[model samples]
Target: MAASLTAFAAAASADTLFGAMEKAYVTNPTLNAARAGQRATDELVPQALSGWRPTVGVGGEVEALISTQRAVVPEADELVDAVINDEAVSGNLAIELTQPLFNGFRTVEGTKAAEARVDAGRQSLLETEQQVLFNVVQAYMDVYAFRQIVVLRKQDVAALEEQVRASNERFAVGEITRTDVAQSEARLAESKSALVDSQTNLARAVAKYIQTVGNEPGKLVYPKVVNLPKSMQMALDAAGEINPRLLAQAFVEVAANSDIGVARSGLLPSAGLLAGGQVSDPDFTEDQNENASAVFGASFSIPLYEAGLVYSQVREAKQRASQSRIQVIEIARDVRRAVVESWNAYVGLGEIIKNTRTQVSAAQLALTGVQQEYAAGTRTTLDVLDAQRELVFSQVLQVTAEKNRVVAGYQLLAAIGHLTAPRVGLKVPEYNPEENYQRVRNKWIGTSVETVE
Candidate 1:
């Protein structure tokens, strides 16, 4: 897995977003934490199943003591007898086994609850994965967008420099005033400053991308094309039945409902089986004696009263379960709203892109005409400078529109909980939580061990 992770990271450094996301899924600390949490929850399964299995234990103890004793005869023949006793020791070894025959269905309820908890943990992991994927997409888009801006800014600077040179030539030939040359110089300086700012933004964006994807973004690749579903309703429908937040809430409610069963089980009778053996040695006799006994018997415990504690617990669990259900409804509503908003924003940006493309084309043509007219002495220096600025503005707008469209696409995916690895064209790592649980659970089930270890 580590080798695979390294390979994926290498690919991401070449600006493969999908590969980067896969690497993050396999090695990112935040996602690993969620996987660990899921594994932790799996332990609950054994705890619940323990009630159905036999528990065995062995213990031994040894003790030694010394004492002095004195005896006195009658007064007529007064005599005293004293003796010191030492070398005293005693020890015993015993083994005990206990098996639950019944516990008011507590074992059954406990196992069910544990299963529900496992489901909840799984959903939580999925949610974490979705979040990580969303971050990767956003960061990737940011780097791409910033790179585009840098290119555009560089071009703007070059255009301004050319205008400045042309203005200087016109002034030397007595074709334009000093004021015209000064204005051209000022525009060139402004373009240089703007270029610096664009470069700075690009640097910051690269840093963010590295942080998000856990590797340097070497040559970022832009997606060749992104297809947006025609409508928000269509997108929501495509999301289908597996929204992470909703799935998590559903499992949480199941867990809470299971808690009610566990509480109710506490109010009923419980039964178990018991068996044991023991051996002992006493210092009074110089010989050690061994004794062993084994007896299988059933035991029962009936609950009479618990100061209404069980009832209270049941009521609390029920309320929590009801709250979880409400949360599911709230999440669904929020998801719908988000989908609609992102869809609208995406559509709006698409229109802007179309318009900006036309604007850029028109500005390019205008700049060409202004430069020719200026050389012909039919247009002023200010006219040429203005045309160049308009062209730069249109180019900037076009770049921004492209970036917004990418971001909106990812946001829509996130809102629908479809931003996870598989949905986003990345590979998800397979992590089986039950693998460890089965190791211990299978050995302990329907059998007795001398020691737990």
Candidate 2:
């Protein structure tokens, strides 16, 4: 099944937008790094839950004592004294356990904060995915458009070459001045230089395409115009609700609020259960003695003061929550602005594309008429050169306008947070952030993690 899917994907990569997007979704390092970051974030819940679990510790100690002492004894009214040496060894082994029963609701609030942060991290991952896809779109269009421009420039160079040859022939026959031939030669050189510039741009575009899409671009198919919202107001409304950055910031604000709760919890009392067992062996004179004991009890603790540390922490958390709320408002404003700008660009490019197409058609006819007139000695050589230049400029404009139109449409979609792999109908499997979160949220003990890859 995997082989068949790979074959199908290979077949679909012949000049397609969805193919590039799908490849980027599966293989782009930027997207994959974001995925890994989010997966790491999934461990936060387990970390929080560990607060409710028991902690166990085991230890042993051995010690040897040596000393010299003077001993005195009284026997029937007579005193006696002697020097003595002493040596002793002792050993002890113990195990202890503690289980949290309560912690001033710190654990509860901490768990809530961790969960909120996980939510925020998921949104952040989505935002990263959106950006990766948007970059792919722009890079793809750039390669396609610049590649076409290079072709047009090559054609222009060929036409100018022909003009130079014709002018040399006329000069040889005394029908045109040397100045005309030189002019044609200069124009040909300029056109060739322009071709080189176009080639350079194409090279840069190809590099970007490879970086974003994780593959060298193939011959790209002409992209279809994207479907947009009916009006600018609709686009703005959609962006306001769905823009990933804005949503992520809103989640961050919630997490920050939860942080305040977690900080406040530090001021309250805590309760736990403690249990232990110990065994010890000691040597006394000629006899060995051993002792063992078991202990279990409930424990409670209250915080009275900490040099105002907890209070300051609570204050800091409140300030951060306020900052987060303000950030949400700022992101909303930026999203609205992006929607407006992208909408205008998308709309404006449509008219420019239409106009440039008409210009190309008219320029082609004008150039042909001017060349014919020059051949008949009814026009100057300069007129024919001007007409050819105009035609080439129009062609360049047309290609650029088409490229901008397509790119602007994609930008509008991105601004509205609709440029997702699923929405674009990419054929690759999608990564589910929640799946990893669910798998590890309550996990008790483990080093290995379940991953999408």
Candidate 3:
């Protein structure tokens, strides 16, 4: 059992963390959904710019008129009456164009707002990507640790079984009492139960692994701790400066303030150029009776009053902008708190891992000594069973401590805003949100540049 445990430990040295991370980076549904969302947000820029373009339209009108007229002819001492009936058909076709010269800077401010929103969306996607990577780290560690515990439990069950057989043999030869044989049997049963529990835990971890990494976990290898900030203060500083959530909120605030500008622009005058031409045919004659007119003019409009609608909208936008600014402050506080907590857990887990390793070694030595003393008739069977149980508990603790240590490191990485595919050097094609933004920012005409899948 011990030899097989050593073999499993040796095989765990394979480096599979990057493979798991790459799988998640490329195929995770949540991350892909965020990418699609950002791509949708990218169209806001072009939609805003549409306000500056020309609008062309064609129109036609047709009508038929019927009339009756009565005429009286004057004669010498006589009166004459005449009735006349006539019908006329008229048709006209007109083409018109209008181009915006100015809209009180509304379009300018609106475009700025859209650009800010796109920036915010990019940051929001980054935040989601970071979260996915962190979840992958946790799931990977869980599977690895649980599998290790399963191995430990199996070995413990086997060892206890052998002890039980030995105790039974000694009782049959009159070398040990029936109570000794029963003690060994009870310990063996308990070990078997623990082994079952470990197996269940391992199965749960595997399920989580599938959910996170988008596939079943294969032979997993241990993950090495990535480099961290030199000090806790440095970590906090980095998080405050570059954390995705905080950056996203800052961009949202900018967008909200831009919206306030857009609302205020409603109070100013708008200017445009209009050009049109119309051709008319009356009396149903194609060339004999026809008229054509052309018109070109510059137009200006100002809202004298709107029953307080525009004013109320301006006030509402101002309040929303204020709220967004306040949210940035709140998010900054939360980020700092997260950084501090992650740092403490990271440090504390390191200490716990060291102590648990020592505990495992001591328990192993104590268990071996107790078994030897029991064979020498100096220690009772119950003493040996107790030592074995202690050893098993220490082994479980050691695995759990290692799991927490690795997870704490990942948590700190996420808190510091460096948990990204490119930052982590995951060997997969990285999705650049800026590429989509640049592709469609100034597009004049199209359904979409490309679909993000």
Q: What digit string (tens of lDDT, one per residue) describes model 3 on residues 1-453?
A: 999998888677553877888888888899998899899999999899989999899999999998999999777878889788988889999999999999988999999999999999998999999999888888899899989999999998988989999998889999999988988998888888888988998899889889988788887777787868889999998998889999999999999999998998889899999999999898675578888999999999999998899899999999999999999999999999999998999899888888888998999999999988988999988998899888889888988988888888878888889898888787788898888888887788677357655
Off-target runs (Cα >4 Å) in candidate 3 are 1-15, 61-91, 170-187, 280-290
Where is the poorest 10-residue window by lDDT in model 3? 444-453
> What would the per-residue lDDT of candidate 1 be over residues 1-453, giving only the tens digit for each residue?
999999778766676667767877777777877777776677688888887988899998887876766656455577666464657777788889998888888888888888888887887888888788777777887788878888988988898888888888879999989999999999999999999998998888878777777888777776632345677777887654676777777888887788888888889899888988887776635674545556667899898999999989889889988998898888788877888888888889989999999999999999999889887889999998899999989998998888888778877877777777655666665655556556555454453322211
TM-score of each: 0.83, 0.90, 0.86
Q: Residue-wise lDDT of candidate 2 within 367-402, one digit each (tens)?
A: 989988998999998898899999989999999998
Arrange candidates by TM-score, descending.
2, 3, 1
Q: Best by TM-score, which number?
A: 2
- Candidates 2 and 3: which is better by TM-score? 2
Better of 1 and 2 by TM-score: 2
| TM-score of candidate 2 versus the correct structure, residues matched by position | 0.90
